[model samples]
Target: MTKHMDLPEIIPIFPLPGALLLPRARLPLHLFEPRYLAMLDDALKTPERLIGMVQPNRMPGRNGGTGLHTIGCVGRVTQFSETEDGRYMITLTGLSRFRVVEEVEGFSPYRRAKVSWTGFERDKGPSETDDGFSRDKFMNLLSRYFTAQELQTDWESLKEADDELLINSLSMLLGFEPEDKQALLEAPSLSTRRETLVTLIEYSMRGGDGEDIMQ
Candidate 1:
């Protein structure tokens, strides 16, 4: 586990729609855009190596500035490398969720935020669950959704994964809409997230357009 003895109050923000990082989950990112590449470069210089993963609000300001969701998860850069094509490949391991207390002005090309982790301190701990997940029900719904989407999966391997890994991996890998993804990210508890995920899969199976949910 990452030792967050002294978490930074300020962090660089990477606002990408449909991308989310939950506590204890891992997110792999491809940094090719110039601004994000610059962000990566600056983060590599810092000791924290922390970045906030947030979603962009659909609406933009008149000045062309993008609006962002208030809540975001902070991730520590655990793995990183540069490709021959000049793109940076990195994996961010989720640390904790944060609230956007305020936006900070910066000389850097990317955005920065002064975030607070008050209500979300629990994100640092293991999730509390009743150990009553309806695995069969969930798998049934997932199967229908996958069939509808014409996707393939190794059912045997998927069934062998533990609850947390299965839930988080599918949440990140699935193509839920931005709003749906945000809802899952902001779920108050693991039980709530599981229920929400099952409902989302049902919705997709019922013609809610699974094809458009991001990869």
Candidate 2:
């Protein structure tokens, strides 16, 4: 496990919509854009191979660029391969969540930010558990949600997955809106995350128009 002090103060930020990476979860990405490819190359040279995965906010940034959310998770490049077409296929294992302090000025093609890891110290520790998790009820709700969305999954595998893996994996893999995914990523604990996940699924099933209920 990585210690809180071991994390870098500044990291290359990848502003992606609808992508969530919770602590201890893995996110696979295909990098075809030149800026992100450059970000990947720079990260690989660092010992930590860290990249900040932040979702872009709806507001326009300075110079009419995309603005990024203040919160983001740091992921370490764990697996990488070069495609024949000169693109990159990589998997990032999440390490911790951070709050953006400020953006650093640089000539690089991608954005960089100074981040703070204040309240998220728990992210560097072992996996968290949710004692109140109602597996059967959650499974039932998930089954209905999946059916409604016309998605398929391996039931046995999902049943076998531990609490953290199951919740975090679903939080990342589910087709929730970018704002909902951000809520899951910013959840204070495993139990809170689970509750938020259930609420989002329930809202979707009830035809709530995918509004941000966490407000």
Candidate 3:
């Protein structure tokens, strides 16, 4: 992670099979499995419990899941509660992009990594966006898709959102396929990611199958 006196020493990361992290958005997750349970315990004992959320690239064998994509967003653990079975219900707020520097050989059921963050180092802001009717058309289609899914959202809030937050949030949470999510997440800038997301959203709105993520 980039070192700034303001940013925490360790930005928390939570790796999940299918979950995705959108910057500036908060995701609530449950920590139940043994390895993750241990991870949560470790975080609880630390000053800042930050986690990275990444999606699996293959099916896992031990946790009975699979491999994860290379990139993920670092999140901070801002809230926590307990379940009856000793699991954790925690809220993770997205912070920055983290690249797994290397894998650590471990005995735990889940994977862990030594990571490097690029938030302070890189300009995450989008240089420009696709203007004109394309953006408007995509928004119209996305609104319809949301309507069909029975999800309620505040359009005003979304419209007012910064470009980075809007693109990242939609890229993570929208109806795109796994690979598409990765594409959006890995886009070099907020503008490019939004353009890609809009394209994917349009395809989904038209009932098309986005490509598989692993390929």
Identify the runs in model 1 with alpha carbons over 4 angstroms from their true place.
1-3, 59-66, 127-130, 208-215
Could you tell me every candidate's TM-score relative to the true structure? 0.89, 0.92, 0.74
Candidate 3 residue-wise lDDT, 99-141, digit = tens: 6555566665556666666553453333334343244555676
Clashes of 3: 13
User: 20-43, model 1: which lDDT tens digit per residue?
Assistant: 799888999999999999998888
Candidate 2 wrong stretches, greater than 4 Å:
1-5, 60-66, 209-215
Ten residues in a row with the worst lDDT in model 2? 58-67
What would the TM-score be for candidate 2 when compared with the true structure?
Answer: 0.92
TM-score (C-alpha, index-matched) for candidate 3: 0.74
lDDT of 2 at 133: 91
Return the top candidate by lDDT: 2
Which pairs clash inside model 1? Answer: 175-213
| lDDT of model 2, residue 159 | 100
Q: Rank the candidates by lDDT, best first.
A: 2, 1, 3
Choose 1 or 3, whichever is better by lDDT.
1
**Segments in model 3 whose C-alpha atoms lie over 4 Å from true places:** 1-13, 59-66, 107-109, 118-120, 123-138, 148-150, 209-215
Residue 120 Cα positional deviation in candidate 2, in Å, after optimal superposition: 0.5
Candidate 3 versus truth, CA RMSD in Å, comes to 5.9
